[model samples]
Target: MNTHPAPATRETGGAIAPHLRRLLEFVEPDRDDVCLDVARGRGPMPAALGPQVRHLTAVDAMPAHAPGGHGASGTNGRMSTVEFGTGPVRIADGDTPPAAATREERRPHPLGPDRTLVKADASALPYRDNAFSLVTARFSLYNLGDPEHVLRELLRVCRPGGRVVIADLVRGNLTGPDRDRIERLRDPDHPGTPSIARLTEMITSAGGSIRRLDVFTVERPVEPWLAGSCDDATADRVRRALIDEVDGGPRTGAKPRIIGGELWFTQSWAHVAAEPIP
Candidate 1:
């Protein structure tokens, strides 16, 4: 078991392959097994992880997580929309995925019948115990109110000897008050990023044995990141803070820098896989 955390690193182009590959490497899904992706929310997971498994269950807290669904969240200047339906599934942001969805819609869907969308609480999964072989969640911890509880639930639904993986932005060692304030301003639902050490503990406490832990960074232009995510006032505050950090006022460990005349910042993330005690 690897207990020591990896150092922060950086990547560009917003490509999804590297991260998705790392998760697959750790989980190593099989075609005959069922996998659950919690808090999927129209993320890159469905397209990337779906093809490799026998069945993929994608769940989100709200209908808005799907394309054309009710409610919307800012993403690359577009919103996720999904047509919803009535079912036993009920989800809430910070809790989990959706319950009902249209299967035959010709609209640009990344998943097929092999995939299912459910609205349910992450902390209170509606599935039977040991129902899945692999379970995962991506980029959702910062918004979760009780990540530990959710992890335990994920483990609970995972079959014995199965694995659970979580990937999210890790608070840099240099992260401090200024950076936290900016993050909250940009996304009010942001509870705050967690350190790699803290995350390891969360999984282990959930009865998972650590198998792998990898760290890397993703770089993005600052302006676009804050564009639709925040109001003018809050965006201004974030910009000022970034400028100060670039000028050496204080480091947020976000690595704010000017590249090709555009302001950019890097966020570190940790990808972890842990197996349940069989």
Candidate 2:
């Protein structure tokens, strides 16, 4: 098992995938929503939904190791800013200067008063129970190393009757090819994308009741997909495997093909909405 964290499983950048509009429409983030996005890696859920909601809190799984001490004291980690289009979203970079905080200093956040960036483990959020009106996790779940425990924590922080939205690159159809293997080839830390059924089952098991589910496909380019995270040699292997699969090799689940003289493949995604049972 790879102990290091994996890079974004699919595409990078802070932009949300277009197909997610359907899922966002289904849940419909409201201005009254105090949302929490768990395991919100480089995936675009938080950036996509933050503008539509009142306040959004994003949780990153990366460990914060404060160096020599430079951030607010007592903070889980230090603060760093990443531009998410609408505004800059602050994220914890694992260090903070001692809080010398007299009476819990409250300063206006440059990232806007509505956005909050927290540095903590997904399996263990520092928030109180029933704190957020919306708890979501996007493509970042599979990287946590333990999705189940993290799911439970997402439900725990969510207020009863609040919604839990999950969107991810799910596995292919029931009897389809083995997409997981192809993904693992690209990301060694990957633990196989789960099926749609498994995703819903996890939500229910984690104390949330299913409200809606949707599936979509995205045609991904081969070269950039490999270039995003894989080293040269690994990329070559993945390319060969995909090409071989295209040439009657065993099904790799990734439906690789040539389009307009460009190598391409497809990824199946699942967007799920669940509500905590009161």
Clashes of 1: 20
Candidate 2 global CA lDDT score: 0.62
Question: What are the per-residue Cα lDDT tens digits for candidate 1 across 74-190?
Answer: 432212222222221111111111111111122344668789887676667789988998888886544333778778887888886566878776765555545556677666756
Worst 10 residues of 1 by lDDT: 91-100
Against the true structure, candidate 1 reaches a TM-score of: 0.72
The superposed Cα distance between candidate 1 and the true structure at residue 181, in angstroms, equals: 2.6
Question: How do the predictions measure up, each by TM-score?
Answer: 0.72, 0.73
Which regions of candidate 1 are displaced past 4 Å?
1-17, 62-109, 172-178
Number of the top TM-score candidate: 2
- Model 2 lowest lDDT segment of ten: 94-103
lDDT, candidate 2, 1-278, per-residue tens: 22121222222225333355545665567788899876533434566677788998876554222221011112322112211122111111211111111111243222445677775777777899899988887665655547787788878888876777787777644844366677777767566777788888888888888766666655656775675434788889888988898888977777787656666777766677777776
